[model samples]
Target: MVASSTSSRSIAVLNTAPTQPSAVETFIGNLLELVIHSIEGVRGRLVGGSPQR
Candidate 1:
C-alpha cells in the first residue's frame, strides 16, 4: 500500500463528501479484504514449516 496515495484519497473524501458514502467506503474497505486474503494465502503456504516447496 502506498501511504501517499491513500492520504490523497482521504483528503479528497474529506474535501468532497460522496453522494453515497457507502459506495466509496466499500471501495476503500476492499483494500483490507485484499490484504487479509493475501496474508492468509501466504500463511497457508508457509504452514508446513519448511520454506522449500
Candidate 2:
C-alpha cells in the first residue's frame, strides 16, 4: 500500500511539473510579443514616412 501511494504521488507530481513550465512559457511568449509590438510602434513614429518599395 505504501508503494502504491508513493507511485501515485510521483505520477501526480510529474503531471503537474509539465503544466507549470507550459504556463511559464506561455507567459514569457506573451510578454515578448508585447515588447515587440511596442518597439514597432515607436519605430513607426520615429521614421515618419512609410518604407518605399
Candidate 3:
C-alpha cells in the first residue's frame, strides 16, 4: 500500500512517526543500552579484549 500526500490522514500518520518513541520509551531504551554496553565491557575485560566505549 502507498501513502498519498494528498490525504490528511496520511499526513497525520507521518507526523506521528517521529513522536512514536515518547520520552519514557526513549529513556528506557537508553537505560537498556547502557546496561548492555556495561555487560559487554565487563565480558571484554574478562576475556582480555578491549571494548571501545
User: For each candidate, what is the lDDT?
Assistant: 0.74, 0.74, 0.78
Tens-place lDDT per residue, model 3, 1-53, is 55565466646655879665466467889999999999999999999989868
lDDT at 14, model 1: 69
Candidate 1 lDDT tens digits, 1-53: 67998889877876797665678778769988888877777887789543323
TM-score of each: 0.50, 0.58, 0.57
Q: What's the lDDT for residue 48 in model 1?
A: 58
Clashes of 3: 0
lDDT of 3 at 20: 55
Name the lDDT value of residue 32 in candidate 2: 100
Model 3 / residue 29 / CA error / Å: 0.4
Candidate achieving higher TM-score, 1 or 3:
3
Positional deviation of residue 5's Cα in model 2 after best superposition, in angstroms = 34
Worst 10 residues of 1 by lDDT: 44-53
| Residue-pair clashes, model 2 | 0
**C-alpha RMSD in Å of predicted model 2 compared with the true structure:** 11.6
* lDDT value for model 2: 0.74
